[model samples]
Every structure is written in C-alpha cells, then in structure tokens.
Target: MKKRLITLCSTFIFCVGVQAQEFTPKQLEQVKQVRENALNSDLSWQLLESITTEVGPRLPGTENDKKAVAWAVEQFEALGFDKVWTEPATFPHWRRYHESARIITPSEQPIHLTALGNSVSTPEQGITGEVVLFETLDELIAAPQDSLKNKIAFINYRMNRHVDGNGYGPAVRARNNGAVEAAKKGAIAYMMRSVSTTEHRFAHTGGSHYQPGVNKVPATAISNPDADQLERLISSGHSVSVNINVQSEDLGEGTSYNVIGEVTGSEFPNQYVLIGGHLDSWDLGTGALDDGAGVALTMAAAKHIKAVAQPKRSIRVVLFAAEELGLWGAKAYFERHAKSLGNIVAAAESDFGAGLIYGFESNVTANALPIVRAIAKQLAPLNIEYIRANAAHGGPDLIPLRERLNAPIFALHQDGTDYFDYHHTANDTLDKVDPIKLKQNTAAYAVFAMMAANSKNKITNK
Candidate 1:
C-alpha cells in the first residue's frame, strides 16, 4: 500500500511537469477554436468535390495532369495563401489505351482486368494460351524453367482487410514482380488477382516494373470475383485458356510539377511543418479516396490554421506529382531542399482515404514528446488516440524526406479498413468520401499543424 501511494504521487508529479512544459491556456483555447472552425466549415468537402469533379483522373504528363497543376495553383491563390509555387519533377511516362480479357476455353465469358503500369502491350490480336495458376509468387518462381511455356501465368493471392492497411505490403509483392518471375518461366503474359478487399467487379490498377534481361510481357489484374471464377474452374479440372489484350505506350521521359502553398509564420519563418498528399493518381479512378481527400483536407487544414492563428513557424502543403508512377515528385522535392532539411521542424502527410483520424503518432526525438503529447491532447476531442509507437511513417510521399535525414515526422492515422475497396479502381469516386469524416480529418490536421508550429520548443529529429 505504501509503494502504490508513492507511485501515484510520482505519476501526478510527472503529469504536472508535462502540462507545465506544454501549451499555455490561451494557446489551448486557440487550438479549440481551430478544431471547432474546421468541424463547422464545409471548405474541405467543397475543395474535394471541385478538384475531383473538375480535374478528374490526374495521370502524370497527361493533359489532365497539367490541368490539375493549374487547378491547385488557382485554389491556393483563392484560399489567400501567402505564397504559392511549383517544382519540376520528371518520370518515365506510360499510358494504357485499352485492356480486355476473357476466358476462351472450357467456357466463353468476359473477365474484368486492367493493365498494370509499365506493362508491355500484347500483340494487336492479343495472346491466347492455356492458363497456368500459381497460388503465390514463390510458387511461380519455384516452377521449372519453361514450365509455363505457351501459357499465361496467373497468381491468385488475396489481401486481408485491416484498419491500418497492413495487408497491402504482403499482397502487393505479387502485383509488383509476379510478371517478371512469370516471364522468366517462358510465360507469354502475366495476370494476378487485384490487390483489393472488395467483392465488386472493378479492376484495380497500379505500378509494375520489368527487368532488364527478362522478357517484358503484358501485366494485368483481374477483379476479385473474376479471380474466384478462374479458381473454381481450374479446381474443377477444366482446361482454362484466356485471351489478354492490352494496348499501351511508353513515352520515355515526362515532366510534372509539385504544387506548393505556404502560410508564413511571424517568428521562425524558416522552420516549417510540411503536410500534404500526392496529387497524381491512377487513371482508372477519379483519385478521390486514394489522395483527393488527402489533398483537400490538408489544404483546408492550413487555411483554417492561418485564419485562426499566426503560427510561430511556417506551414507548407505540397501536392506531389507523379506519385502514382513512383515517388518521383517526393524524391525531387527532398533532393532540391536537401540543404535545408534540418529546418523542417515537423512533417506529416495524409495519403490514406477520408476516414476519421483514429490515432496520432510522431517520429521525433525524446525532447519533442511533450509537444507531441500536447498536440495529441488537442486531437483527443476529435476521438483520435495517441499512439506511443514513436515511429510514424507519414505517407508514401514522405518516403524521400525520411530517407534524407532523421527529420521530424508525424502521422494522423485514418481508418483504412475500406480504403483498399475503391483504391486504384473506377469505384474511387467523390461519393465514397464522407463529408463528416473529411471535416474530422481536416480538424485533426489543423490542430496538429497549429500546435506544432506554435509550440514553445521546436520539434526535433531523433
């Protein structure tokens, strides 16, 4: 009983010390105001609807990509941001013209599929061959050389659903390199189950690559239901043959721009908090859930913070370019700003869909925990929990930023259980985004950015 009393007293003292080191009451009130304003406003939804509706799919280097850049600049200017600019990024440009597949032997029926990025085109007439099924990529690799001769290799791996989207990595391995492995086995084409968690018939499309020595074959993904059908037919001892037709082009190198908007600070203008999402998305979808929500909410968050309070450090929202093809924009941004990396006091990105932010986390030095905790406290009213992992990988766009230095990074984790359902598919439209959830996401970013900028002590790297 005596030991328990001592422990309770120690806990109280530590809490009091942390509270003392954190924001003042007036600052806390400002945070409350920002949160409330964000929740009450429909700015985020308006931005999301306008961008997704007006710009449509923003595949890099397309005319739509150019329009997206102009749209972002116009929006930033209209939002009264202090400064707006663009940075150039170059990437290998590829486009899909048409993709179609169907079961030819055993039964005749259409199968839904989309060509993977960087996939080579099939012959004009397409390729028809016996179907060779592999449950996993490793199984395909282990098959004897020429085992898949005159066959189309198919991998039927399914991704599991999780709130944090942990299954994406495991399932995407096949999507990324299954084609290369299949080509090595003398396959004429490669196909796999879509890396999705949906029952719908929308085929998902994403990035894939070809190796130097290996023959480049057409890579594609079929809808989940179609994959199930193929599995059933093959399991029933039927000789399944498929015809795959994909017409695509590789346009060598192309350039895109990263749109940037800044809200300057009064005190430490050079030190900044970076937050945003990739602007470029797969052409198959409108890119609403994949990144349009991220773009809109982050843009609105900075606008809200600027309206309510003049932060001590600047806030920069970067709409990355060519992210769907690769992290090209992120790489260029970090490389161009490499010398000033240490000036980035705090950074976060929202590439996940417009789900409620369920948790807040930071990857920073021990001394920065007080600021993180204070920010988490402000986020608590929005039903966001503090994840003490201290290992926050903000988003795909921040990958380059993280690789450069031990930069201060943060993540406002959204509920991604249904994000993969519409991700990279035609179903990722504006209707999938909940306005209420977007406002909550906006409020979370607003509070986090405002507090990080206005903190008494500067956030630091680990």
Candidate 2:
C-alpha cells in the first residue's frame, strides 16, 4: 500500500511538471511572427516546383532515387541548415517495363491499366483466360475454392472520397492484399479498378503484397471507365476473356537513404520536434501532390523557423525514403532512434496532398493539451481548428516510433476530398498542387513545430 501511494504521488508530480510548462508573452509573439512569415513566403512553392521539374519521379533505389538524394543534400546545404545527413535504407527494387490489358472474347476492346509495383510478370506469350469480376474483396474471398483456376480475377471496388481521406482505409485493401487473396482461390492473375474518386482513363499504381506461401500472380489496376465497361459486359450475359501482360521485374533489395536536416536549438539542442515526408515516389508521375509537396513543406517550414529565432529544442526535418515500397526508411529510422524517443517533444508529418489545413489532431499527454490548445488558438488565422481527441499516429512513416514509445505525434489534417483522384497516377503532376495551399500548410507546420520545440513541456503524461 505504501509503494502504491508513493507511485501515485510521483505520477502527480511528473504530470504537474509537464502541465506547468507554457510559452511566455515574448515566445507567443515570436510564434505569431513565424506563422505570419510562413503565410507570405513563397519558399514552399519554389522548392516544390524545382523538385518536381528537376528531379522528377524518385522511384525507390532507382537512379532517379539517387539523384533525389543528392538534390536533397544540395538543397539543405544551400538553405544553411545546422546539420544534414543521410541514414541507410534497404528495400526491394522493382521496375516497370510494359503493361497492357485487352478483352479478346465477346468483343475486342482495350483496357487501360498499369502494373502494380513489384507484381510478377505474365508469361512470354501472355495469358488468356476468362475474367472473373467481384464487387468487393470480401466477395472474392467468399468465392468457392479453385473457382478462379486459370482465370484472371478483377475486383471492381469503388473508393469514396472524403475530406479526412478516411475512404482510402477500406478501398485500398483491393491493392494492398488483393493478389494474395486471389492466389488463394487459384487465380492466374489479379486486377482491380483504380482506387480513385475521379473517373479518368489513367490507372493508378500502388504496391501490392503476395504472401510467401501463396502462388505468385501478376496484378494490375484498370481505369474507372474500363472497369465500368467490363462490369456492364459481365451483366450483359456475355462471357469475357482478357489477355493481360504486365511486365515488372524484381531485382532484389537495394540500398537507399533517409535524408535529414536540422535547425539546432539555442538551449536544449539534443531534444527535438521532428517533421518529415517521404522522399521516394511511384514512377508514374512527378509526385507533386502525394509527397513532393510534403518534402517542400517541411523544409520550407524549418527554414522559416530558422529565419525567425533559434528555439530551445532542435527542429529536425527528415525525408523518409522508400515509403511507397512499404516504409523501408521509416522502419530503419525507428530501429536507430526508438531508444531516444523521450527527447522528442512532438513529431509531425506532411504526407497528405497539398490542401488547406482544416483541423489539428495530436497524441500528446493530457498535461500538454493546454499547450496545444494555445498553439491552436494562434493557428486560428489559418482557419485551423483543434480536435480535442488525442488519438494521433503522426503519419504512416511515424507508425513504428509512435507505437514503440507511445509518444506524441501530431497531424495538421488537410482537406483531402480530391486527393485520391491523382494519387499514384500519371496525372499527379505539379498542377495538382495549389501554391497558396502549400504555403498554408507550411505556415501551420512552422508555427506548431516552433512552439513545440521551444516549450518546456514534456509530451508524455508521466
């Protein structure tokens, strides 16, 4: 009983310490200036334009990926960051050669499609088989055993668009795990509709996984219009056969790097408030919306903070690598940094598309809520609202660290209603991102990152 009482007292004292930390009037003035400068600055747009136009697509472990690494280093050095470095990352290297799909039976027609990343190629002569269609992944899994033998399975699942981008949660299962499920039912190949909200002829490509024990199969994604036509044909009582040839080669694992830059603290230099975005992208486009914007946003934000005033804790900006190929860089970073998580006051990511930041969410302890709330009040000029909930995972790349330490990660939730339309498609070019929105995102990040890094509060409850 005595021990329990002592433990509770210690917990109370710890929480009190965190709760007592707050920004002074002078610090609040500094944060406001930082936010205002970010709003007027064109740094984010300029960086994004330069990256998308100069470096192009940064496919993992490819020559383009290497160039991107060099470009990041050069940019960071030019920006006068306190320190810049790269962490090693190893991931599977896959290349796309050719991808085509055609309906050979019932009627001759072409289906626009792109090969899923790391998907196995069809035979040299290609495979001609009846196309089996499913409305959902669940339907395909419920089909009889061996029903898809020597056949191509197509899952025509529709993805709904949302402001929060929550719709991607259910619809992406078709691409993430569809191949394995189809192989379980003896499918020769698997295909699906693009996980998009817009009905464009361009097919979106993403990574798909094949279970180790399951049979290998080529997988592809067709455009929404082609999927609609195929569904209509299926409902017309006419059997359809498709000849699909998706050529992709896996050249084994290759090394990449997680590029990092920092704004060193004036006082507690060892502690951090980290911000990041993935450096790699799909091969289809310049990755402007998916992550070029993120890269530019974080970098520009840290630069703005450095221009304003030196904070108490470091603001480290990381460009995670090979995120589209299954978080190779994120996992590597966690393995190297997990033990030092206590020093991280907060972590945030800007991977979502460039859009107006509408809401703010975080995973910090209750003791830090007031500090966050105060920051949110400052963010009001940007039209950001604070969500009371503490359930935040930071970003996809931050998953390992957040789960390991149960530490704080924050999100500046964007208006992602139209984000999926160009996601992973050939249309994900520079035009997809709005310049003002990118600046707004940068502004929001700069304020929050500066405030968190300068604060005396700890992110943990006790």
Candidate 3:
C-alpha cells in the first residue's frame, strides 16, 4: 500500500510538470504574428536608401557628419517616434587636407595612398627618405634605432578575410599603433598597407593612436597594389627612396551630439532596450556599408516598434557621434547617463556593415538563457542562431556601456565576408548595399528588440 501511494504521488508530480511546460495556444499564436509582421516590414530598405543617398559619408567633425545628425533627427521625427532628442558631446577635429606618395629612387612613380585619421602633416614641402620595410611591428621594434633614423618606415600587416572577419581587431593594430611605434624607433614618417583583405587600388583610411607624450609623425596607408609594388622593388636589391606628403592636422575640439529616439513602453517604461549605430564615418567613402546601413536599420526597427504600439519596455535608439576617430561620443554619453545604466535591460549595436544577421550572443545571467533562446527560436525563420557567450568587446560605441555600466550587450552577428572589402575605402557607397540583406537585418533587429522589451526576465548582472 505504501509503495503504491509513493508511485501515485510521483505520477501526479510528473503530470503537473508536463502541464507547466506546455505553452498556451494563444501565446503561440502571438509569436507567429510578431514574426510575420517583422518579415513583412519594408521600412528597413527605405531607411537605408534615404540615409545613404542623402547624407553620404559622415566623417567625424565634418560637414557631412553634421548633416547626418540633422538627417537622422528628421528621419526619427518623420517616423513618428514618441520622442526625439540630441545629447551634446565634443570631438577632436581632424581633416585630410592632401595626400600624395611617390617612389623617388629605383623608379619614379606615384603610389596611391590615403592619410590615416589624426595623423600629423609633414613639412610644407613634404619628407623624402630611404624606405625601410618591416613585415611586422615587432620586427620594427627589434631593429636598431640607427636603421630607422632619417628613414620612412613601412609596416605591412595584411588583414585576413573570414566569415566573421575575426582578424580585423588584431590586424588593425598596425594602423592604430604603427605610426607611434615607428616614431619611437626614430623613423621620420610611417606608412602601412591599408587594413583590408582584398587587393585593390583604393586606399583604406582609418583612425590611428599617437601615444600622449610621443611626438606625432605623418602617417598614411597605401593601397594593396601599391604596397605590393613597393615591396617588390625593395626585395629585388633596389634601394628605394620615397617622398610622402600628408596634410592632416588637429584643429582643436568641436561640438557633436548623439541623436536619441524612444518608443515609450506600455508597462515598464523605465526599463530599456537600447539599440544604435555610430553616425560617423571616414571621409574616403559615402560610409554606406561602414555605418549608413547601421543607422538606417536601427531607425527602421525603432519606427516599426513605435508604429505597432509600445512593447513592455521602452526602446531607445542612439545614433552615436565620432565613432570613427574615437569613441568620444559613446564615452561622453555613458558618463552623463551613468546612473541610468542599472535600468538598462539589454543593448545591441549594429556597427558592422549592412549584412544579413546570422546569430546573436549576450552576456547575461544564466537564468535569462531560456528567454533568450525562445527569442532566438522566433528568429530562426530568419535564419538567426543563438550563441550564448560573454561579451568582452562590443565594438567602439558600446564599449563604454559594456565596461563602465556593466550593461549586458547582445551581438547580432552579421555576415562579414565582404565587409572588409569596402570598409574605410572609397568604394563604400550606397550602390554596394543589397536591399534584400538590409531587409533581413531589419527583421532580425525588430524581432530581437521586441522580444527583449517584452520579456519579464531582467537580464541584470549577478
């Protein structure tokens, strides 16, 4: 009798557990409805077209950047977002005045190059010296100081292409630190192979860091083809002397701002789902794939959510400033809004080029995995997978929030196979974007942001 009673209790418990696990038919229907709505939305493509065509390249502290900010404000307001505003920040002003390079010895030929952001200008007449080649930065560091004295050092670190472009971070170090490192070794000037994977005649221009106390040097990046040609000449037992001139300078600080829009929630108004892309780009291209795509996607997603009625938590869109030269915009914003960080539920950034999103990862509590998984499953129709992982670096714009605020960042991994080809190059323009892929990315963001805003689980740090 005792054994039978125990068995009956066990069966009852199992039955209750199974009942709890089943979802209500109404809830399942709601999920399907949300997915369908996102798939059908056309706002994504429209937004991309408008921004890319109207604003073009938005280099930091330039006229294009200011124009982009105004355009974004108008776009958000036109989309009927409940609130639109701008937060002020300051950014260092640097402009590319002129860039030219030529091989003076071995052969007299012009080499294509672009000045790196924040690079100093050479003398009015420019600098001419023998070329010293370093396959890597470490090699240059190991060389005798006398070897680099009165010479122009060239660092040739090539970026490897991958589906995720995971090589970009490390590969970019050459561009970021190469100039300063060479200056320390007594080089008169520095040049590097553009941080790109493909061999192209177009030079890639990006930001470089000069150590605070070190003297700044003229720096530029040569196109892959030009770098290759220069390398061949040097390797063939020819003494190569080069003339380089880059008129880049710091013009003090200037005012910039982050554009913000919000769709107020129906319930948890204070809790937030933040999504954004940097509003700044390099001057070389239209910044279409670099960030115009990102801005458009975020705006479209926010507009859609607002049109459909507010979710359970507020959806905030932040178009950050000066992401190209530095993360000054993000840093300033974070400092001003530090207290509100605790209220932020989760954040996502779309800085990667306009590509179809394939997956998402988050640094959140383990208990929130089920909710995140459920959301990912909703996105499965759009071919988005979920990879639960910790967020260490969440791009430039989101880095401040991730570190200082300890905000959980969600990475919407995009197909970066072709991102490097146009990144920071003159080829990055509106024509490079595919409307179909833009739509797909918008759909992913819409579903993910909606689910995150509606969820009851708080993804707070433990």
Candidate 4:
C-alpha cells in the first residue's frame, strides 16, 4: 500500500513538471503561423539584396559605412519598429587604396595578395626581399633572433573546412599578429597564406594589429595557389625573392553608430531579447555572407514576430558598427549598458553565413531549462535538434555580453562547411547565398525569438 502511494505521488510530480513547460494551444498556433510566414516570405532576401547591392562594401569609417548606418535607421523606420536610435562607437579607421605583388627572381610571375587591415604601406616602388618561409607561426616565432633581417616573412598555414568553422581561430592567429613577430626578427614585411579554405586565386583581407614597441611592417595575405607556388619554388632549391606594394592609411580614431530598433512589449518593457549582426564588413567583397545575410534575417525575424503578436517582452535588433575592425560597437554597447544587462532576458546573433540552422542550444540556469525545452520543441519542426548540453556561446558579438553577465544566451547552429571558401574574400557576393537556405534560417530565428519572448517563465542565466 505504501509503495503504491509513493508511485502515485511520483507520477503526479512528473505530470506537473510537464505541465509547467507546456505552451497553451493558442501560443502553439501562433508559433506555427510565424513559422509558416517566415518560410513563405521573401523579406529576408529582399533586405539582404538591398543592403549588399545598394550599400556595397561597408568598411568601417568609410563613406559606405556612414551610408550603412543611415540605411539601417531608414530601414527600421520603414519596418514600423516601435523605437529606433543609434549609439556612438569609436574605432581606429583604416583603408586599403591599392595592393600588388609579384615574384622577382628565378621566374617572374604575378602573385595574388591583399593588404591586411591596419597594415603599413610599403614605399612607392615597393619592398623587395628574399622570402623566408615558415610552415606555421610557431616555427617563425622559434627562429633565431634577427634571422630574417631585410627579408619578407611568410607563414604558410592552410585553414581546414568544418561544418562549424572550427578552423578559423587557428589560422587567423597568424594573420592577426604575424607581422608583429616577423618585425621582431628584422623582417621588413609579413605575408601569410590566406585564412581561407578555397583553391581560388583570391586573397582574403581581415583585421591585423601592430604592437606598440614592435616595428610596424607591411602585412598582407597571399592567395592559396600563390602560397603553394612559392612553397614549390623554395623546395626545389631556388631562392625566392618577391616585391610587395600595399598602399593603406590608418586614420585616427573615427566615430560611427550602432543602429538599434525595437518592438515594444505590452508588459515588461524594460526586459528584452537582443538579436542582430554587425553592420561593417571587409572592403574586398560585398559582405553578403559574412554579415549582410545575418543583418537581414534577424531584422526580418523580429518583424515577423511583431506581426504575429507583441510578446510579453521587447525585442531589440542592434546593427553593431566596426565589428570587422574589432568588436568596437559591441564593447561600447555592453559597457554603456553594464548595469542593466539583466534586462537582456535572451540574446543571439546570426553572423554565420546563410546556411541551414541544424541545432539549437542555450546557456541558462537549470530552472530555465523548461523554457528552453519549450522553445526547442517549436524549433524541432524546422529540423533543429535540441542540444541539451545547455552551453551556448552565441555569435561573435555576444562575446562581450557573455563576459559581462551570465545572461541567458542561445545559439542557432548553422551549417558552415562552405563558409570559409568565400569568407573575407572578393568572392563573397549575393550569388553565394541560396535563397532556400536563407528562408530556413529566417524561420528558425523567428520561432526561437517568439517563443523566448512570449514564454510564461522568464529565462535566467546560469
């Protein structure tokens, strides 16, 4: 009799737990409506095409960057957002005017290359030197002091392709600080194989920094095929000499704005869900895959949610500024709002390429798992699996937010197998994005945002 009573009690508790997370029939129907609308709508594609085409490359502090900020404000107003504004962001502005390279000895052949952001310019005639090749940055760092005097340092690290883009960090380290280290050895310039996974003859351009005491050298990236050719020439007992000319300038600190739009909530107006992507891009390409798609999809996601119903909390879409130059806008934003970070009930950013969202995960307290699981249930129909690990770092912009607070963060994992092929290169254009995949991405964000904003129980950080 006692055992039967215990079993009955356990069953009752389980039922209550299940009931605690179940959404109302009306809420479920609303979710379905939003999903269907996002899937059928071409709103995301329209926004992406408009920005990438009309605005072109939005390098930080450039004319196009100003245009992008203005464009975002105009777009927010046109979309009928409840509130729209901009926050100031200052960053060291830089520009690439021209770049050219070629092998000078053994056999003359033009090499494909581009100056890394913030790189110093070589003399008008260019800097010609014997090439000192190292397979990796560590190898270059371990070399004897002053071993590369008056030479051009080259690190040939090839990035790998992964569905999650795990190779970027390892390869990008060489791009970021390779020049500083090479300069330490008296090298006049630094070059590395592009941090890309493509065989095409296109050099990738990304942010690179110089140290205070270290001499600044001309930093650049060469196309993968060119790197391979240089490797072959060196291995065949031929001393390789090259001429590199890069014209760039670093303007003093420049100011930009982080454009933000919001949909007001019926209740809990102070609390909000943050979703957005950076508004700046590298100048080499149209910046479509790197972030234009992200900007458009997140904007459309919020609009779709507002169309269905105003959630219990607000949703804010922040188009961050100067992200490519560094996370300047995100840093300024988190610092400006440091005290009220608790208001961010949920946050996610879609900076990855417009690929199919295949998984969903969250970083929240155990008590909030019910809310997350409920959100995950709605996303399941969109083919997103619930990753119960409950540890989500979110996108790059969220790094500052994550460091500032234990705020609830989420990740809608997208398939990124081909992202690096065109990332930071001249080939990243509208044609690279598939409309079908972009639609799925839009629907996933809408479902997650709507459910997260409207859930009965508020999600809390770990």
Cα lDDT, model 2, residue 363? 84
lDDT value, residue 207 of candidate 2 = 88
Encode model 3's per-residue lDDT on 342-399: one tens digit a residue.
Answer: 8888889898897788987777776565556666666778888767565535556988
- The superposed Cα distance between candidate 1 and the true structure at residue 187, in angstroms, equals 0.6
Q: Using lDDT as the measure, which candidate wins? A: 1
Q: Which stretches of candidate 4 lie over 4 Å from their true place?
A: 1-22
Worst 10 residues of 1 by lDDT: 8-17
Better of 1 and 2 by TM-score: 1
Candidate 1 accuracy as TM-score = 0.97
Lowest lDDT block of 10, candidate 3: 13-22
Give the clashing residue pairs of candidate 1, or none: none
Cα error, residue 129 of model 4, in Å, equals: 0.6
Work out how many backbone clashes candidate 2 has.
Answer: 0
Instruction: Give the count of colliding residue pairs in each prediction.
Output: 0, 0, 0, 0
lDDT of 4 by residue, 1-462 (tens): 655554454433223344244466687789899999999999999999999999989999999999999999999999989999999999998988999999999889999999999999999999999998999999999989999999999999989999999999999999999999999999999999999998999999999999999999999999999999999999899999999999998899999999999998788889899999999999989999989999999999999989988878899999999999989999999999999999999999999999899999999998777777777777878888888888999998899998889789999999999999999999999999999999999999998888778878778999
Per-candidate local distance difference test: 0.92, 0.88, 0.81, 0.91
Better of 3 and 4 by lDDT: 4
lDDT of 1 by residue, 1-462 (tens): 655554454433224346445677788888899999999999999999998999999999999999999999999999999999999999999989999999998989999999999899999999999998999999999999999999999999999999999999989999899999999999999999999999999899999988999999999999999999999999999999999999999999999999999999889999999999999888988899979999999999999999988888999999999998989999999999999999999999999899889999999998788778778777888999999899998899999988989789999999999999999999999999999999999999999999999888999999
